[model samples]
Target: MKITNETLATQLNHRSIRAFAKKPIAKEQLTAIYEAARHTSTSQFLQQFSILRITDEAKRKAISEIAKQDYVGGNGELLIFLADLNRNAKIRQHLGQDIARLQTADLFFQAVNDTVLAVQNALLAAESMGLGGVVLGSINNEPKKLVTVLELPQLTYPILGLQLGHPAQSPQLKPRLPLEFTVFDDKYPADFSLAEFKDYDKLVHQYYDLRDTDRRVDEFTTQIGSKKLAAHKSSRDEIMAAIQDQGLCLD
Candidate 1:
């Protein structure tokens, strides 16, 4: 496809903005972003998601502390995206339908897919409007505490935290793996080479080094290996447990 449209250009140059200006986003822009998120396609027309706008300073700060990311709360606007099945549950209850049907892994994954798609659409909308934002996964550091802080009801779980605002800094766009490493044809390739990883790692290391000369940054392979080795210590390791407690029986 030719790079002819403004929308395509905006997406092509997408970058996360952590530092935000004090100025707030205009109401019209906020409305557009929400509309974009709401219009995202859902599985089987099940709109299994909700956007929780965090306006309270105390709550935002508390959330930031939990996430261990100060920029999350200090951003001009904060939104917690949730995979919500509570509304559907309520509807089923009203209609005398079996609530156990919502307890399947399929439905749970559908909610996750719905939430992610909606948030991606919202982020794209924000970028198209010249606004900047970042998706915060750090908020899941303490899922139980986050539930208490947000008071998320049953049949709902926090999926991601999104921060949006006027841009205060313009960081360089990080490198992405080549399409061959990710995108495939009709079927998966049986064998892959490490040549691409080596090339990408060098590029990434250069990017980080140039971006922040004060500190050393590990290469891509090292970073990935480190996380892989510490998989057990991941903050979201208890996700299934939390989901079960939230009444989403994914067994």
Candidate 2:
């Protein structure tokens, strides 16, 4: 028996929508989505997140280049979610209080959490309203470049980019690891084996990605083993330095 509600259905049917229709989202719907994001739970009642809506074609194109995703700058609403402690720092400066704590790694992590939660809330709200979107972690490929592109202030870092619009394609539902492999009891399993993923690997190999319909993507295990976990450093390697440059103390 499948027990589900509207929210559950929306979540279960989630697909990364890269291609979007030319139609613009209604102002009221956009407002509702923003409101939902604003109302997301914050750590210690400290809302450390900020959302930047990118409408300028030039900026969008620059961000797309940073992400290396053409669809990003094409058509849709582009929103960049940021982990921002600059606002709190300003508040403390105004009160003549110590602003050092705001720059700590602990506070930085809290702000990141706030930003990620807000993005989830915003995406779910949009999905509920019959919209489709994709989360662009790719923007972090060049953190410093992204900071320069957005003119991010001190004590703020870009967490993710969200592209929201009406979906133009219906892609196949991506498969996930079974509960036995993911969900565990109070304590984690004592041991696991790669052999356990054989069935899952087969299922994944059979799946076709909309991006490349000509051939099925590599199996889940192979993808992680070869590509995802491979240590080929790039601009992403400077992420920590970029964060520190933004005035966040990681040490």
Ten-residue segment with the worst summed lDDT in candidate 2? 208-217
The lowest-lDDT stretch of 10 consecutive residues in candidate 1 is 212-221
Scored by Cα lDDT, where does model 2 land? 0.91
Scored against the true structure, residue 247 in model 1 reaches a CA lDDT of 89
lDDT of 2 at 11: 96
Report the backbone clash tally of model 1: 0
Candidate 1 lDDT score relative to the true structure: 0.89
**Alpha-carbon lDDT, every model:** 0.89, 0.91
Most accurate candidate by lDDT = 2
Instruction: Give candidate 2's error at residue 174 in angstroms.
Output: 0.3
> Candidate 2 on 75-97: residue-level lDDT in tens?
88999999999998999999989
The TM-score measured for candidate 2 stands at 0.96
